[model samples]
Target: MPIFVVERRFADQLEASAERLDGINRINADEGVRWLFSFLSADKRKTYCLYEAPSPEAIRRAAQRADLPADVVTEVSGRLMPDGSPVPIR
Candidate 1:
């Protein structure tokens, strides 16, 4: 599976309310895409979601099904630590 970074920008404040999060989780159940994690900007205007899927198109489909914004989907090749060291995969 390839990892993808999905970016989304909100017009105003980005709210990650429990209900909205639940909705996303629900939509992901059968989308063939796994939601690894997400980062919400401090200003609450943007969100970056990390996902594992067969292709970027899968990620877009998941977002569309979840009714969430999918501004950009980029394929990522690696993950690293805050210290700039590569994180070992088990």
Candidate 2:
């Protein structure tokens, strides 16, 4: 699987109820995309989400189905360690 960092921007404060979240997860699963987690900006108008999927296109499709923004989809190889070294994310 490939890991991706998705940047989404909203016109207003971002909000999603638990039921809406469950629906989004179901939609993601249908597209073979796993929602790892997300970080919210201080204003809560933006989110940086991590995901695992077969390809960037799969992620895009999932986003489209969920009617969510996938403003930037970047593939990441691994994590950066404090010892000035790179480590595999898995």
Question: Candidate 1: where is the Cα deviation over 4 Å?
Answer: 80-90
Tens digits of per-residue lDDT, candidate 2, 17-69, equal 99999999999999999999999999999999999999999999999999999
* Model 1 weakest lDDT span, ten residues long: 81-90
lDDT of each: 0.83, 0.95
User: Which 10 residues in a row give candidate 2 its minimum summed lDDT?
Assistant: 81-90
Q: Candidate 2 — what's its lDDT? A: 0.95
Model 1 TM-score, all chains together: 0.80
Q: Given candidate 2, what's the lDDT at residue 75?
A: 95
Positional deviation of residue 75's Cα in model 2 after best superposition, in angstroms: 0.7
Instruction: List TM-scores for all candidates, in order.
Output: 0.80, 0.96
What value of lDDT does candidate 1 attain over all alpha carbons? 0.83
Q: Compute the lDDT of residue 14 as modeled in candidate 1.
A: 75
Across residues 1-90, which tens digit of lDDT does each residue of candidate 1 receive?
788889999889876789988878777767888889989899988989888888877778888888778999998877798999986332
RMSD of 1: 2.2
